[model samples]
Target: MTIPPIVRQVVVGASASDAYAAWTRQIGTWWPLQRHSVYKQDTSVAFVDDQIVETSSTGETATWGTVISAEPPSSLTFTWHPGHGAERASTVTVDFVPIGADRTLVRLTHTGWEVFAEPLDAREEYRGGWVGVLANLRAALPPSSGGAEDVWLILEAAPGLAATGSVFAHPLFAEHLVFIDKLKADGVLVAAGPLPDEPGHGQTIIRVPASEAAGYIDAAHDDPAVAGDLLVLRVRPWHVMVPGV
Candidate 1:
């Protein structure tokens, strides 16, 4: 028996044209090099010779799939065979719908699981895999007009501060807010707030170009709280599935 398709969606703060271009043209930049690829060390991924291919530094090539549909700025559908050959291929359909002038909803549906020898296993793997993949795509694309984009970063309180529930009372807390405000003024920060349920934990969503994300992260780590050991910092890239009103 076959299983249902794996469907995932994210709201990218970019024009449909920009989102589609990043997804197709500049996929290598944000795709997790360590986690998702046919080879342990993949040099790059690109659309070449009618197939989406992953090439390794050693010059070995792995064909991901054959392109069946290529509609720019709207939809793309392709056969997917990451580990196997064309004989054991599945189908993936991605739709880019413009929800606003500067926002596009990217929906991905992976179907044809029966093509794999172990359909359930493949489905399970891809279920988690697509999450990271979309996050990478989100980071790769540029922000939309109005200076807004969706990117993920990490926040960690100093070890003892979190356990003692005293992060908010720390002397550097006010200075931390000032630092965050500076980032917002620079159009790099979108929203940031403490996690009520998780004491001493917080998260910040920022809008910046992918190339500059590392610099922004370094700046965030220099926050007085983090730098002074009142808080610890951890950063990871993320995609926003829905935008707040």
Candidate 2:
């Protein structure tokens, strides 16, 4: 079979808001420039300034694109034309769809490929280009809390820590209450809660930086529930949600 000159509708995962951010706000942070340009030495696909239209060695290259359709986390379309100055260039459309918790579906499509001679070549090149470009998008997503931050630890725990748990009735568990409350106040505790079970055995996630995690972990050892040998096996990790720790 012959590959068509134009490739249409490339999709990937992300949120509606993030989808918009990916192209408008977050484009430069992730779009890989190493794979683009007539000489593969251009810097136009994406960059830091968020306003870097296109740049070449002297004056041999130029990029033209404006986001025509943008709904954020849903769809984004733009016109792409660079260097060589063909009579015409292709139009690219990208969409970001929500898949599930913390995931987005990203799709990309390019039209006007017929404007180029070897449409098959264009498709093949884009197949690989999309691979790298999308990979860059995956890397650009922000950490939890709807933005980037330091270490984020997602925690899960049982009911003994809840206000209505079996042990919660025991006033002697004051230490647990004291420490839990303090962590919550310090902002080091991203989130916490008793289990959702009737008996209240649930989990909580805490997002904090390594520099601040020690304080919380150290204090956890003092909880009456922990000290009393009731709560066991608290798993811990200094997590990196955005990589490049």
lDDT values for all models: 0.70, 0.51
Q: What is the lDDT of candidate 1?
A: 0.70
lDDT of 2 by residue, 90-208 (tens): 77777654433454445566667676687656655765566566656655663233323344544334432223446556564566667667778876665666654545344445665
Q: After superposition, how far is residue 157 of candidate 2 from its true place, in Å?
A: 43
lDDT tens string, model 1, 125-241? 887798788877766654344533334443334322223447888778887899889978987777788888886778776766544454565476567776554565544345656
Please give the distance, in angstroms, between residue 56's alpha carbon in candidate 2 and its true position after superposition: 5.0
- The ten-residue window of minimal lDDT in model 1 covers 154-163
Show model 1 residue runs off by greater than 4 Å: 142-245
Task: Write down the RMSD of all candidates, one decimal each.
Answer: 11.4, 17.8
Error of 2 at 199 (Å): 56
- True-vs-predicted CA distance for residue 159, candidate 2, Å: 54
